[model samples]
Target: MNKISIGQSELMASQISLGIMRMNALSVEEAKTVIETAISEGIDHFDHADIYGKGASETIFGQAFKKLGISRDSVILQTKTGIVPGIMYDFSKEHIIQSVEESLTRLQTDYVDTLLLHRPDALIEPEEVAEAFDELEKSGKVRTFGVSNHNPLQIELLKKFVNQPLIINQLQLSLTHTPMIDAGLNVNRTEAGSVLHEGQLIDYSRINDMTIQPWSPFQSGNGKKGLFFDHPDYLELNKVVNEMAKEKGVAREAIAIAWLLRHPAKMQPIVGTMNPDRIKAITKTTEISLSREEWYKLYLSGGKMLP
Candidate 1:
């Protein structure tokens, strides 16, 4: 596995991370197998969210991790907080502090390598967030801070008050879901692809030296439908991906992930597959490098047109 420095921090992690969102559905033994498989493939970073499986995922992961007997410092654990399910998004100092405390208890750890605000709270108060971060940092509960699904201005709003450098901004990016990349490529065009939905976050992250963590790397960009691997709308994309996989002697999943790694942004894709075989296959991404021509071919095949 290839290691990339997260943001400006000294923390170095695998270019691809395993997301434990669905770990709640697995028994302790099964979860252990999934985690062990990932670690064996050189994946040292694990991503989690407080809202995942209603905290059950974290509990299971904690149990499995303890059974493995691995040193805490050997792996990086990151979790997101602030979503209250059906209630509302909360960024209050009380919620932020309390959330991490609860997460620590469930994760079986005294501190997390990183903590992220799950999603942008419409009623976010920068001062409150800053206070929460200050207390967490001083107490050694969270080593680093970041945000997920936040736009450039939203990140700037938090940076205005939060003292810690927001080292990461996790976003959804895939070959089929290319709004961020499309906007940049279609600049000044009258086409729908010219609409800048994310405020050009790809450029913003690179300019600010913040790492962009791409989540849902294989999604079809359509809700609840499933991965793009065999999605009907993505037949062209599937063809290109399969051809590349055959040429490179890798699994189709690696070609999809390799497309993300081909970007200069150096995004760390969070792969959420729980299958041990899939985990092994996906890790093969590190061995293959997508050329510029091949990268564009895959992109164009994903129902995108270049001006």
Candidate 2:
């Protein structure tokens, strides 16, 4: 897998991340195989969330890591917090501190390599977040901090008070769900795609030296419809991706991910596949990059247009 330094941090991580959000559905042995497979394929960074399966995903991954017998220092562990299911978003100092403590215990580790705020809290107080981060950093509970699904201004608000570097911003991005890219490419147009939903997030992330981690790389939309692989609505995209895969001599999944890797923004794509074979196949993305024309072809095939 390709490696990149996250933000200004010295922590170099694999460009391809293994997201264990669905690991709670697998048996311990099965989860171990999946994790070991990812490591073998050069994926050292794993993404988790405190709310995934009500924290069962982290518990399962912890058990698998122990059974795999790999040294803790060999892999990078990142997890998210602040989402309390259907209740509310909590960035309070009390919730942040307690959450990390719980995640630490569940993962059987003293500290997480990276900790992220799972979602933005409408009722956030940056000073309270700063206090929580100070405590976590002083105690060595979290090495780095970041956010997810946050707009540019939201990050600016946090940066005002938080002393630590906010290194990552994980967002839902795929060929078919690219409001950020659309807004940038179709500026000043009256089309729906030109409406700036994310406020130049792609540009902001690049200019700020923050890594944008794209989750659900294979999904077409909000994921309510499912994978776009053979979806009838995405015939052109599927056809183009399949052709590219054939030409590249890799799986179709690899082509989809390569589109992300080809971007100059230096994105890290988090894959959620539990199948060992699928994991190995997608790893091919780091080996190849899409040409400028090819990249645009795939983008247009996704039904996005340029004015």
Could you say which candidate leads in lDDT?
1
**Tens-digit lDDT track for model 1 on 9-81?**
9899999999999999999999999999999999999999888999999999999999999999999999999
Each prediction's Cα RMSD? 0.8, 0.9
The TM-score obtained by model 1 is 0.99
* TM-scores, all models, native as reference: 0.99, 0.98
Clashes of 2: 0
| Candidate 1 global lDDT | 0.94
Model 2 superposed RMSD (Cα): 0.9
The number of clashing residue pairs in each candidate reads: 0, 0
Report clash pairs, candidate 2.
none
